[model samples]
Target: MLIYPDERLAVFIDGANLYATARALEIEIDYKALRAHFAEQSRLVRTFYYTAILEDQEYSPLRPLIDWLDYNGFTLVTKPVKEFTDEHGRRKIKGNMDIEIAVDMLNIAENVDHIVLFSGDGDFRRLLEAVQRRGVRVTVVSSNSTQPSMIADELRRQADQFIDIVDLAPIIGRKGPRRQHHAHYDEREETTREFEDAED
Candidate 1:
């Protein structure tokens, strides 16, 4: 977590990926605290959060959290999830936000001195490299404490700094019991599970 108070900082959060990583560590993130933690570190530019919604549902499980984030300081980037049947006749959903995140990061790179990525997906290795080439420092935050390790080796290597999410648990984790079923927390868990099932 090398940071300077004068540096301009931007945060990009892969909502589902982060939710899964936190869950694996048996910790519930205090979103407000997470934002404040970074805002205190440097000149906060903007925080972007990405997710996909099952649009066909009358009321999505993610709606509440989405609304809260939108109303808060986070810039929400979302799209409708596509439902389709696989070759094996299994119904699946597809809604990857990699392109959106990459494009946004690239577009904002010149303005920010540092970029904080809150995801462990290996697919973003090239994106981080590209941003670094533009002289913007990149910090990747994800857990390496899980059985299989939540952060990808390549992605971790690509980042200028790698911070394990577990280390920040004390600062950004919820203060109550570990497994309480708060509505927003349950929604995030369900949404992450849905994405995982689709990928599988």
Candidate 2:
């Protein structure tokens, strides 16, 4: 559950992870609404969203969304994408903002009572533990609804609470006339399906 109401809260969003979660849920997060949802529940000290931008290119499709979040209430922490060649000679791009996220969370530990982390990268399990050691209650928001599950098992267990992203839709769902796309939903039950099945 979202322990919102009276707790002092801060949201640390792994932008890419959040996008995938919402995409899997077949919804676009109304960033404005998401802010309001938390504000209504607690004192929202800061809203941090971390992402990597492809500034090397003249154009990137995700630019607009990033711009909106920056202009709005979010504190945007972004970096450039790194291009590399794998052993197989395949080109790949990787963008990591883990260090930034971990640093910001530690910095804010004393400022807030509850910390909401929106990621499922499994690697963050240690980060969660560290934050909790400071007496900050942590809540992880990701999805088991995604194929292999977006929320990592260790992270869920480490946090004071685990909030499945599916449960947040009503607070963050689209408003106005929605031109629905085929949600790209799974062929099998989201929860019953094994994590390996959705790793794609």
Candidate 3:
């Protein structure tokens, strides 16, 4: 939340991670409002959203949301999800965007004065450190409001500032009944589950 109006800022959103976090908190994020909130805080440069799509599906549940974000102010970076069977013969989907996010963040670090990362994955702790070393201030947006706490302790500690999504709910959360993209939310949850299972 500590932002200066003159600072150059960029937002990196891990789509699946954010969706899971918000769902855990029972909050629906208004993407427009979320963008506006950050734009108001600083010299917003860009917002990048990363996700993976199931290429083989006849009609992807996430297509609507993906299209919406693409038409919006967000930069979409996505790839096809790989479906494979595990050693135990269990089907799994692998679609982690961690590398893509890291590469983009590092590429933009020198140009931006600040970066706002929306993810709770502990894997990014070192990435935050690297950005900070380059004189870029990093703010992590996630939450500890859930029963198990969505934000990783080490990731929170690595950030120059940590803003809980719970606190941001009032400003960027949906006001009334959810929009038509409700189905996309369900798909995100399922994707998160599959991604985690694959990682395990």
Candidate 4:
């Protein structure tokens, strides 16, 4: 949570990874609150969210959330998931957004003073290094409070600033009446399971 008033900022969110982190922490993120909190911190330039969709599905549980985010200040980056059969003859879907997120951060590195990434994936260690080379300060937001610790050690060490999401829960979490066993929450859990298994 280090902040400088004049620094320009951009956010890159790895949708599935963030969802998993928040679920592990047992909190719901108020996207609006999150955007506003950072906007108040500095010159907020842009926010990017990445995910993969199953194009063949007639109905997707994540459609509502995805649509809401698209219309509400987030630039959505998505690709269709690819399905294939393994050698064992089991169908599997694969999707990964690391390259997309890295490209966007690198593309905008020179223009922004700060880049905030919302993912714990260790693969981004090099991406952070590259952006730091361009003089952009990188802040990684992920939790180390969970039982297994969602934040990767190498990624945490590489970031110029690391803010554990658990500490920001009070500021960014949704407030008022969320049932622990709500049907929507169940849907989200199911969606996470599918995506996590499919992720490459």
Candidate 5:
């Protein structure tokens, strides 16, 4: 995280992207710790978390974590997944929150001196470039430590700084007693697996 105490800052979290990144690092981020880590670095004005939900089941798999984040200080941004059948008759859910993340970052660029982005999707390269044009410094957080780096080459190169998620373990990983893998959310769920083609 490229944070200086005096700088004004905000965080934009791409939910699915972050979950997978953290998993690749073999760590679970304590949300409260993650937020406090930034708060200590700057005057954190906002932390926006964006994700898509599949409504097929009566109860979505992510409801618990989603509810927790909303009740916390973080701003929860979500969109419903649209179901469609492709030409091959395979059902796919379409719900990408990239626009939401990009728009919020640009909207607040003037108010913030720094941005902490938690996803490595290459598509955000243009967004980062645009925000830089508006005079905001960007810190991209993802891992190159994975088998095939989670961050895009251009996005990582374009960022003012890139902080691999593994490096953040000591700063944000779980502390104290944890019971029965209580913190483990179902990583194999559909939405979580959708990133298999992240490079595709």
Candidate 6:
């Protein structure tokens, strides 16, 4: 991660995209540590995490993690996912948060000297360009080390700096003894995976 001591940094996280990327790399992020790591790099202004929730469900498995993040130095932005049938007559859930993240980044651009976007979505290339015009440096964090590559080429090119998340796993990822093999861990991972799968 490129860091300047005087830079005022803000983080915009595309929750589903990040979750999927991390899963593809077989790592789980420790949110608190990730925040602290960035804070150490510069004047951390804010960290925004955006996601979609299925409100119709009796209980959401992600509620615990969401609540944890909300109280742990993250600004949570979420909305209910919309369910609909496509032209092919297959059920699908719509929960894209790209606009929300772009809007927030634009709103905060003037205040922050740098933005670290945690997404590989190519749709954000224009947003990054707009933010750059305002003199804010943008750092995209996603992986190209995955089997098929997680970071979109255009998005990577648009960024002022591209930091692959796989390289930061040692600093931000959870350390444990084969976490995915445990039932409890699988339940939580599955919850995140379900939404991310729908997103992609």
Q: In candidate 2, which residue pairs clash?
A: 148-195
- Off-target runs (Cα >4 Å) in candidate 2 are 2-4, 177-200
- How would you encode candidate 6's per-residue C-alpha lDDT over 16-68 as one tens digit per residue? 88887888888888888899999999999999999888799886766777888
Superposing every Cα of model 4 onto the true structure, what RMSD results? 2.4
| Per-residue accuracy of model 5 over 1-200 as CA lDDT, tens digit each | 55789999999999888888887777777888899899988999998989888766776667777787788899999988767676787766666788899888889999999999999999999999999998899999999999888999999999999998888888888777653332445544455665343224
Where in model 1 is the C-alpha error above 4 Å?
Answer: 177-182, 187-191, 197-200
Alpha-carbon RMSD of each model: 2.1, 5.8, 1.0, 2.4, 2.3, 2.8
**Top lDDT model:** 3
**Model number with the top TM-score:** 3
Tens-place lDDT per residue, model 3, 1-200, is: 89999999999999888988998998998999999999999999999999999989898998988899899899999999999998899888999999999999999998999999999999999999999999999999999889898889999999998999989999989998889975578756766899977865
Give the per-residue lDDT digits (tens) of candidate 1, residues 57-127.
88786787788788889999999987888778977777788999999999999999999999999999999
Clash pairs of candidate 4? Answer: none
**Residue-level lDDT tens digits of model 4 in 1-200:** 98798999999999889888998888888888899998999999999989888789887766776787788899999998777787888777767888899999999999999999999999999999999999999999999999888889999999998999989999999889863322255576765665667664
CA displacement after TM-score superposition, residue 163 of candidate 4 (Å): 1.0
Per-candidate TM-scores read 0.93, 0.85, 0.97, 0.92, 0.91, 0.90
Global lDDT scores for all candidate models: 0.89, 0.77, 0.92, 0.86, 0.83, 0.86
lDDT (Cα) of model 4? 0.86
Model 2 per-residue lDDT at 24? 77
lDDT of 6: 0.86
Pitting candidate 1 against candidate 5, the one with the higher TM-score is 1
Clash pairs for candidate 6: none
For model 2, the run of ten residues with the poorest summed lDDT: 182-191
